[model samples]
Target: MDPFIEINAIRKGLADGEYSSAEITKFYLDRAKKLNSQLNSFISFCEEQAIEQAKNADNKIAEGSSGPITGIPLAHKDIFCTKGITTTCGSRMLENFVAPYDATVVERLNKAGAVTIGKANMDEFAMGSSNENSYFGNTSNPWDTDRVPGGSSGGSAAAVAAGMIPIATGTDTGGSIRQPAAFCGISGLKPTYGRVSRYGMIAFASSLDQAGVLGRSVADICLLLSQFGGPDVLDSTSHPIPDNWLSSNPKLNPTKPEAKITIGLPREYFDQTPNLKSVEIAMRVFENAGCILKEVSLPSTESAIPAYYIIAGAEASTNLSRYDGVRFGYRCQDPESLSDLYQRSRNEGFGKEVKRRILTGTYALSVGYYDAYYLKAQKIRRLIQQDFLEVFNKVDLILCPTSPGVAFKKGALSENPVEMYKQDIFTIPSSLAGLPAMSIPCGFQNNLPIGMQLIAPHFAERKLIEWGHYFQSLTDWHKKVPELS
Candidate 1:
């Protein structure tokens, strides 16, 4: 089996008998074991279970009952609860917790015949912009080990980037999926908030968190979405779709030469970014892609950062309060009483960034300050959504750099929290709006990958995927693998 085979190619190989699912699974398992120490991409590896699942897929293949992803190997971010597997959520609080049932994303993918080989690492409680905040350890960029893989889906992105896995599951709350995809030079999509099921996935911010995919190309995301894109009764947040939802999307015809689409470039991104060299280079790829590029404005974009933090923090505080010492997570030693237990357990369990956000959120949600901070932020969030809604009406999709600049040195932004927050300026507004956004490798700058982001209107992932696939067809940016030694 070719180690760098794309996910779709792997599926084709399985059907054509070129390679068995077991062989492919073993190849990835070996690579994950070999490079995990270097990249710290996986919190736990499930070699035995994955092999069994692969064997099952082979039986299904032999019986001619296999589906699109029936035999593919994938990694799930540790935030999704995997039955009988330790789901740490990259935090010490849940370090010892093993979920009794599978998350909806895990269950749906498993039913689609995909094999999960391991649990990818992430930022602690999905709080940080960098994977350095993980209790396990930071996941390093496969392109350059000294540089950080953007979080909290960094491990998933790193694994896919290194050819250790052809595809992986990720959760996006803010820029977790897209930012890391940009950093690692892979393709990732943060689908609309409720398009995919959230049941069984650990909650961060209920309104902001959404499960998505990261892969070697846009085509992989399309395939995965077809398999798992519908509703789940277990997850009330998942939208109910018509029975023919799969066939309802307009087919993407990338081969047509005269197929020109309108792409909007937000003035806020161009005006606010400190450096735009890499972004400028990436937009050139868009120019020659038969797009009618037009300048647009999302006036509330600057307020997205502050608004996102307030809402995310408030929701996180509420969701995370369940991790009291009485629950099934880490409890502090020698607690004198209930108060001591709650205080010490949280104090001892959480990382610095997680603690900081919790405090900020607690204050924002407090009685006197709730109307001033949380309420106002929600209003600003509505304004941000309105800005996107208005611009999207005029353009088929929006394009911009996934990050303000290329990947920075590890630990550089650790001391400057505000600068670290700004790292998400380009990616957060879409998240706030519950829109579908994608990150594809656009070019390289200073030896690091530059990611171009494509955002579509709510439930318009088909458009984003169509544009992404068409863009990837015209350029080899998505095909450039990091030369990790």
Candidate 2:
């Protein structure tokens, strides 16, 4: 069995009886178990449950009732609740927590017959950029084990890159999905905000958190999205699925787009270091495809980092208040009073980075500082959104580097929090605007992968897929994989 087999090929093989779902499931399960020690990509394995699901999928295939994703193996980020599976969210607070109900993303995928192999490790409470904040330990990049796999979706990206699974579910509160995908050399999508249901997924920053996928290619992501992307009654924020979003054949090759398609290059994003030269070289593919490239301005780009941190921190503080040790999560032993219990439990259970954000958030939302900080940040958020909306009026899509540079060493930015936050400078603006964005491997830098980002207008995911698929067809970047021993 080929570890890098495409999702469509897997589907065809299962339908033709070339192989059984049980066989493929076991193959990936064994591969994951073998590599997890070196990479630390998964927190827990669902071996027995995965095998059982594979058998059930085989039964469905025999009955001719299998769906598109039926029998396909996938891993879920630990932030999502999986019934009977431990959902640690990469924090000690939920280390022993087992969800009683499946997250909407998990439920939808299960109904499509995809088997859950395990829960991928992530930054504690989805807080870090380098995956070092994970309570379970950092996830190593498959390309270079000494380096970091970008976080908070680092495990998902690394696992997919190493071919442990064809695809995995990820959430992007800021650049969580795209950054890791770029660092690990895979395709990742952060859909338009509210495009996918978030119910039962642990909250990071409510308004900014969006569920997406990391995969080997855009086609694979489209196949999975067709199954799970849609409005859900449980999540009020979920958007209605566009009528034409899912076509009959999800893997159909996209036709050449009309010549009038225009992509914007924000001057602010382009004024960076030499590593972005790879992204500039990649722009020619679009030119050769007859698409127009226009230089545009997004002046608010400088303010994005500060604004994003403030907004995300404020929301994280409010959302995390539930884990006070008085309720369901980690509780301190033998507390004399409720206050002591709350203080000790949180101080001991939460990680350094998570505690930092909580403290910053609390201060921002405090009585004397609400308007001085949080309110001002919200006003800046509006400006950032307006900047994207203005640029969209002049172009159909925006192009930029996904990160300032390629993946760095594990401890490189751990001590310098400000420098670490700048790693997301390119990805943050699009996220703040609630637009659909994707990261695809474009070229290699110093033996590491370089990723270019594509941003489309709200709900314009199909456009991104079309352009991204076309780019992959021209370049072998996405096809290149690390030679893991």
Candidate 3:
């Protein structure tokens, strides 16, 4: 088996009997254990469970029964609950919490035959932009050990980049998927809100919390989407996407005249984010591909940060209230009173960042401030959506830098919380509007990867995927992997 082979090769190799599913599964598991000490990506390794599933997959393949990614090994962000497995969500609150059931995303993928490698580490309750918030410890970037691998989904991206796994699950609420994908130099797709089910995924901000895929390329993402997308009765937010949606979508072959589409370059992004040489090279790649770049302005971009914080914090405040020691989660040693238990458990379980957001959200949703904060932020979110809707009228997609700059040193923004929030300045607007967006490796700066974002209208993931596939087909940016030693 080829060590660097991605999703497509793994599937084909399995079908052709080049190697048994057990062989491939063991290969990844071995590598994950060997490299995890350096990257700290996986909080839990399901080696025995994975090999058992792989054995089942081998039997199925012998009988000629398999799905697209049958026998393919992947990882899930810690936020997704796995049955009988500890769904830590990167916090001590749930460090010992064993879920009774799998998340909807996990269940569907399991039925499709994708083997689980382990539970990837993430920010506590998926709250922080950097994986530094994980109670288990920080996940480092594969490119540079001292630097961050982006956040919330950093463990997923770092693992994939270092060749520990071919694909991983990610949740994007305010740029978690795309930003980390950029930082790790992999491909990540954050589908429009409700495009994928959120049941049992351990909610952060329910309204903005949507699961996505982080992997080698757009083709890999499309294959996963074909399997897991569409309606799930378990989640009311999981809307009905057409069956076999990828094949049904318009072809994005750039060579054809019909494939010609206008791409929008947001002027707001240029002035605010890091205008590095990599950004210039990325723009040139699009221009050289015959894409007509037109200047587009999302005037409301300036307000995305404040609005996203208010709204996300408010929702997070409500969702996290469930962990107050009474039900399951962590319980204090001895509780004299119920209030004491709640106070002690929460303070001990949650990290600094999680506590900060909870406080912010609680205040925003508090009486006399609800309308002034949460309600107003929701209105701002609408304006952000309208900005994209109007821009899409003239352009097929919007493209910009995934992050303001390349991956920063792990402790760079740790001191100043506000500085860390700026990492998602370019990504938050798209999340605010619940649009389909993706990040693909574009260039490198100071030995770190830089990512460019492609965003489409709500549920327009096909177009976003098309452009990502086309770009990756012609460029080797996504193919370049970090040299892990």
lDDT scores in order? 0.88, 0.92, 0.88
Q: Which stretches of candidate 1 lie over 4 Å from their true place?
A: 242-253, 274-285
Worst 10 residues of 1 by lDDT: 242-251
| Cα lDDT tens digits for candidate 1, 162-224 | 999999999999999999999999999999989989999899999999999999998888877
> Could you tell me which residue pairs clash in candidate 3?
none
Count of clashes, each model: 0, 0, 0
Show model 2 residue runs off by greater than 4 Å: 241-243, 247-249
Ranking by TM-score: 2, 3, 1
By lDDT, the best candidate is 2
TM-score, structure 1 vs. true = 0.97
lDDT of 3 by residue, 410-482 (tens): 8889878888997899999999898999999988887789999999988888778877887887788888878
For residues 1-485, could you state the per-residue lDDT of candidate 2 as single tens digits?
Answer: 88988899999999999999999999999999999999999999999999999999999999999999999999999999999999999999998999999999999899989999999999999998899999999999999999999999999999999999999999998899999999999999999998899999999899999999999999999899888888899999998665265534355575674556999999999987566777887898898788899999999999999999999999999999899987688999999998999999999999998888888899999999999899999999999999999999999999999999999999999998889998999888888899999999998987899999999999988889889998888888999888898
- TM-scores, one per candidate: 0.97, 0.98, 0.97
| TM-score of candidate 3 to 2 decimals | 0.97
